[model samples]
Target chain A: MCQLLGMNANKPASLHFSLAGFMCRGGRTGEHSDGWGAAYFEGHACHLLVESRPSANSPLARWLHEQPLRSRNIIAHVRKATRGAVALENCHPFVRELWGRQWAFAHNGHLKDFDLPLRGRFTPVGSTDSEHAFCYLLEALFRRFGHTPPPTPALFEALAGLACEISGFGSFNFLLSNGDGLFAHCSTQLHTLQRRYPFARARRIDDGVTIDLGRHNHLDDRMVLAATAPLTEDEDWTALRPGELKYFRGGQDLPDGVPVAAPLLLAV
Target chain B: MCQLLGMNANKPASLHFSLAGFMCRGGRTGEHSDGWGAAYFEGHACHLLVESRPSANSPLARWLHEQPLRSRNIIAHVRKATRGAVALENCHPFVRELWGRQWAFAHNGHLKDFDLPLRGRFTPVGSTDSEHAFCYLLEALFRRFGHTPPPTPALFEALAGLACEISGFGSFNFLLSNGDGLFAHCSTQLHTLQRRYPFARARRIDDGVTIDLGRHNHLDDRMVLAATAPLTEDEDWTALRPGELKYFRGGQDLPDGVPVAAPLLLAV
Candidate 1:
């Protein structure tokens, strides 16, 4: 299994603190060391960096940690290479253009016997089940809402149905973002944490480093983070139940009040 | 107008020396100070870096100059913001996926009245005539070839016809690469140089920095470089004619021997 990390912020925020602890899972504290990738979204543009080297030792990853490249949405992955070769193309998080915006996806769990027929609308350059699933999800969205993206509630519902259907193959824990919103689905394991105005001090779970979140954040700052495992020891990290899908936008989870029907083509 | 630089090598060779001179044009030596981008292709994977900052003074561009990341195909651009805002999304060397391969394109000139109808296949994420032209080119290719990519000679012919058709709108000098080959189309200004055995010393035209190519390259190494202007002072750079299209694979230009007709949809 790979490890995934995602962040959504009301304002452009840096992932420096979270990445310090999360990247340790790539080699230092965990076994997910095959490859690593990170995508930072600034408006409709995404700055993506991926490497076949271990994140713990990669110079580029270290550079990323040092540079405070702020973004509204970010997704990262540390791969263990369960489904694909340990090459640069197979590194997550994978990026593609959809609906005139750059979309990024990263998977934490493996999928078994996933033989969904691709309609050539979105094709995977890598031979990973994760990429195949991402392509399928994007293709479904494109087919349903050709060119015009649906509203947030409808998109969330469509993604939820698609995630449920894909989870039937095997484990499908994944995080996806298209700059405007972040959607995380849990098939087996996923955790989420929200940071608001009244922030507190926290300690890194991987290392013993401690930090005061209040010092780095403003009064209006709000952010949501999702990872395969909790990165901080003191922060309140909520574990999502299996087969649950969570939607976050502007640094807060949307209240589960919007009603929408299942997707039209879940039978596929 | 912006500046474009591309390199196609028989081996994965570093662009350190060429970039040193090319980046100087971003701000220090020339007037293209809006933004800059570079795409380095390693196999089917592309490591893309773009910043809404001048390449001459940007920290990321400086780091790129310091690092010797080698690639068989590389494309770089320094933007002057002829038709778009100075944002990350509007930076040159725009990338998209086509035929299970990442395709990168960088344009140096501006287009006038380019209002082509998009087919919702490959949409431009940024508001730039260059990106619009790139999307149109890719959409045309996809419409012609469907899921399978055509042979090099056939692709070259298609691209040549498309280049000619697009140039009818305005100046359309560009560099395009899909890892396997580099295609250069010259509407007004473009130069090409090839370095092979018997390498000699060269001086940067921008900053007068000197380097002995023989010291860093093997005898069997070969590379073809395309730029808006000759990067080196002592190299025999040939100026391409207007409306000329050149294709380079494995560091050498494909001789004009493959007989192929113009694309059928050039009338469109």
Candidate 2:
């Protein structure tokens, strides 16, 4: 189907090992060879790259593997087209702006009867359900709070509620962020791992590569990793329970009992 | 938050216009600025690139905007860390393999307690729940049908079921593929658009730029684009329902009631 990879850490880190292995699915080891994309966040700025070539064996993919790109937060994807024809416009890892803050998103499932609603202010450039969702979410946010972002707890509660509501219609596993925190929700199959002190050696299942976090990462740094499935052989990954959503900041989950914001309707 | 952009067409297409606008979110217009990445799919492979720099002004991002990279399918992402420590190891759009096919995925949400019981067969190289979920899906597919991929209908049904099972945890919106077709699921936010005859000049919502797709695409070629939000200023984007999933092949949805090999796992 598709694969997703995300990392949250207390310090700058590189996804070279994970990306190297993930690239194999672009063309070498598998056939999601539609296109690939990735994003890395550095404070209020980000670096983005996109291509319509397989990542496993593509020159670009190879170069990236050796480039050792680093960031405190990152999101990457390889695509297998579901809607949109196999064209550059239909790739994954879409980015947008809401309340002057940058937001990123990637998806792994499909939706039914997804029609673009003519939401005021926010509109879509491409023709995909993923974009519609993003627009809708932001439109709702803007509708509820105008230009100011709500408190983290309030925002989280609202987002979680909206996510849960959206999940009822179809599969809605996704990863979202706003430079302040990373939010993840699993509808069907998603997993996560937190790496703290005592990092260990990990072997990639797709490419059979191994790396020790202790050697690669600073010991004091804490990290959280989430994906559709496990990619390493040595570490333990926890699967998300049905209808569960979590927020991470500095690699730690936020406490519960956050006040929820009022729901905003999609702009039409 | 995170963003994804994708294009699928019968022939290769470039994402210059869309990407140009998306890059602004890295730092110029928005803030998904943890990192940036993109990939292209050609035949049975993908070409990938990632940079841990601000895409809005990154030399590489600007180069890509001017350099036309063409492909039949594409994927890209911009990230803001909420989980794993800020590092390259925690990137989105993780790729993997199963049944001798490459698979790619990106996410825009977070999963809680996503650490699932992962066997040594499939593991995560990064520390994102998104990758873990991807591996689990592949592992289940491999386990269900062994090495040889099942028929398309059978495979779709199985994967769809798996998607539903995982969605129970949280939001499970995603896009998946194996060179044959694309599978997408919506848990919260997802959008899709199809462009056929009567192409028009579309403007980027993020960058205030415009492009005439009719000049770049052929009358005979149709395309579908998916994203986290609409990139263009004027376009219709369908929003995915909470629990909806679908597949697209050559810019068309799969016929309904096509003997799905597995039963829809409602319980999951």
Candidate 3:
């Protein structure tokens, strides 16, 4: 198993604080040392950084320590190489273009026998079940909606249905973003926390470091963070229910009231 | 106009030597201060680093100077923002996946009214004539030859014919790679140089620094470099012909004997 981290903020926010603790899990605090990757959405573009080396010891990771890439949405993952070779192509988050926007996806858990029909519209560059599932998900969406998406709620409903069908295969915790906001699904382990006007001091779960969020955040700086495991110990982190889909935009949760489509028998 | 630099090597080689000088053109040596980007191919994966800020002054560029990401094929570009906005989306080399392989592309010149209708399979994330042209090129090829490409020579022929058509719109000098090798099409300004067994001392044209390449490379190490301008003053850089398409693999040319298909009236 791997790990996933996501951030959605009303105002563009820096992720160094959370990323510091999160990267430690790549090698220092945990054994997920196969690789590490991240994607930060800035305007219509997603800047992706993926390394096959362990993040805790990578030079790029060190530079990221100093430079704060402010963004409204971000997704990150540390890999343990459950279903693919330990290579850069297998590193998440994987970026693809759909509807003229760069979409990035990252998976934390395995999907057994996820051999989906690609149909040539989308294909996996890496030999990972996660990438294969991702491509399949995109192909399904494109087939249904063509280029532009349907109304927001309709699209959400379709994604939830797709998630439900895939989760049946195995643990399916994943994070996705298309420069607008973040979409996350949990089949096994996931946690989420909100940071807002009333901030609190937090302790890093990995390194035991502490910081006062109140000093670093503005009054309007509302944000949501979701991860496979909570990065901080002091903050209140909510455990996402199994087989749940979550949507976040501009720091607030978009309630998952959209009903999943009739159980999909669509399997490869 | 922008600037392009590409490397195809027999052995996986470090790019610091060429990149150190190439990056200077983003602000120091030349005036391409709009943006800059680079792509390094590792096996079937391409690690891309792009920034909206000038490469000569970007924090990421400074960090890259200290680390060596060696690869067999590489492409870099420094933009002067002739058409699109100065943003991350407009930064090249732009990457898209086809046939489950990541293809990276970058251009050095502008095209007037280079609007091409996209058929939805591929689209540009940015509003640049360069990217639009790129998407059109890919669409044409995919339309003719689905996901899997024809033979190598046949693919090269199609690409050369496409290049001839697009170059009619502007000075379309570009470098494209799909991890295996590099394809270069030069309309106005481009140069090529080969570094092999009898390497000699070289001085950087941008930074005025000198290095003895003979000492740094192995006896069998071979590389071919293509750029919009000669990076070093001492090297024997050959200026590409007014209209030329060159293919390079493992540091050697594949000899352009492939015949171009007759021009078609497929204007978008």
Between prediction 1 and prediction 2, which has the larger lDDT?
1
Q: Write candidate 2's Cα lDDT for B168-234 as tens digits.
A: 7777677776555567677787787777778878988886778888887788877777777778867
Compared with the real two-chain complex, what DockQ does model 2 have?
A: 0.03
Poorest 10 consecutive residues by lDDT, candidate 1 chain B: B255-264
List each candidate's DockQ score.
0.63, 0.03, 0.67
Which candidate comes out best when scored by DockQ? 3
Could you give me the TM-score of model 3 versus the true structure? 0.95
Model 1: fraction of native contacts: 0.58
Clashing pairs in 3: none
Off by over 4 Å in 1: A256-268, B256-268
Q: Give the worst 10-residue stretch by lDDT in candidate 2 chain A.
A: A116-125
Model 1 lDDT tens row, A32-138: 99999999997798999999878988888888887869998999999998988988889998999987899999998878999999989888888999999999999
CAPRI quality of model 3: medium
| lDDT, residue B261, model 2 | 42
Ranking by TM-score: 1, 3, 2
Q: Write the per-residue lDDT of candidate 3 for residues B1-268, one digit (tens) a residue.
A: 7999999998999878888999999998889999999999987889999999899999988887787678999999999998989999999999998888899999999898776688988888998999888889988988889978777788888999999999888899999999998999899999999999899899999889999999999999999999999999889999999789998887877777243454898989
